[model samples]
Target: MLKGKTALVTGSTSGIGLDMAEALAREGANIMLNGLGDATEIEATRAGLEKRTGVKVSFMGANLMKADACADLVAATQKEFGTLDILINNAGMQFVSPIEEFPVEKWDAIMALNLSAPFHTIRAALPAMKDAGWGRIINTGSAHSLVASPFKSAYVAAKHGLAGLTKTVALEAAEHGITCNTICPGYVSTELVDAQIADTAKARGMTEKEVIQKVILEAQPTREFVTVEQISGLAVFLCSDAAASMTGVILPIDGGWTAH
Candidate 1:
């Protein structure tokens, strides 16, 4: 579906990002994987994706929290691929604490990586996307983008800001055949969530299964976690010609988490 296109997914070494990268590759888009991880692991992932999907796959290891590093990643991707058709800003992390007790450093780090990095990437990639006359920019937001939770002030704030960014970019790029949208997901079975579950289990003296159930209960529709493939499928749809008219939209694959 995306033959000859180039797609860059940040923080793609593992978790949701990795799944999305593979999804894009399966659609025949050349992949540029980004993140900080084991060199061998990164290379192996790149090689594996390329071999499996028969699409070019490359890696860019950049600390996305740094503006300069983000800029460099954009430059390197453009240099290698010559043109970029898709940009998925999927890099983010969480630091949980009460707003009154939130560490300044943690707040700053979350803002840098979760919010500022996407802005830098969009700015850098816009010119190329605009010139191409067609592009897709997918920002990975969270259900928190619409509704906040306690102890996740920085994360919620950054996601809310990202939602705004997505809308604004969509408006600006509307005339140039570029579509910008945010994919807001609820709790997913990522390594990050696994750690959270473990922590909750230990802190509350509950079993892992009970911790998972409690997490689910927080949402209106208490059930399964959102799957990476489910989110990736939406990304694929957004990149398709059929979705040309969709922009400035927050497509929540959050199992009705925000509907309430």
Candidate 2:
């Protein structure tokens, strides 16, 4: 359905971002992947996606924490593909600490990457999308965007801000045939979440199993993690003509976590 279209997926070297990039590629969209990883592994991922999907694939290790770098990533995509029809703002960071003890630097970094980077990229991508009269902007928000948990002040704040940014973009871009929406996902068993589980276990004086069952999955009434395929599937749908009217929606793929 996306033949000849180009998608830029940030933080796509692995995990949910990579899966969404691949899903878009398989549906006939050229892909630009951005993230940090071993050079060799990243190259392999890039080459493998191109081979498997028969779509042009490129990789850029743009540091998303910088506003200039975020704009440059969009520019690079336009240069490589001549256009960027879909923008997936998926790069983010998480830090857990009480508000009083949270490092100021960490808060700044989280806010930069999680909130400011998307603003820069969206601003840079909008003009061309407006010119083309069609575009899709999908932000990877979290359940935190709607609800908050303790010890996640910076992360929750950034995600909540992202939700607002997405809605504003949707409203501003609606008339141009451009759509902006956020995908709010709950827990996913990725490497980052794995580290979070271990850290919570140690901090809360619980075993890993206990943390998984009691701390992480406790709010997720389904007692399951959201899958990468499911998240990417919704992204594909949002890009389809069927979802053309679905702008400014915070569609949650959490396992009934927010339903509480």
For candidate 2, lDDT tens digit of each residue in 161-245?
9999999999999999999999999999998789888867766788999999998999899999999999999999999999999
How high is the CA lDDT of each candidate model? 0.90, 0.95
**Model 2 reaches what TM-score against the true structure?**
0.99
Off by over 4 Å in 1: 199-209, 220-222
Global local distance difference test of model 1: 0.90
Tens-place lDDT per residue, model 1, 111-136, is 99999999999999999899989899
TM-score of 1: 0.95
* Best of the candidates, lDDT: 2
RMSD of each predicted structure: 1.6, 0.7
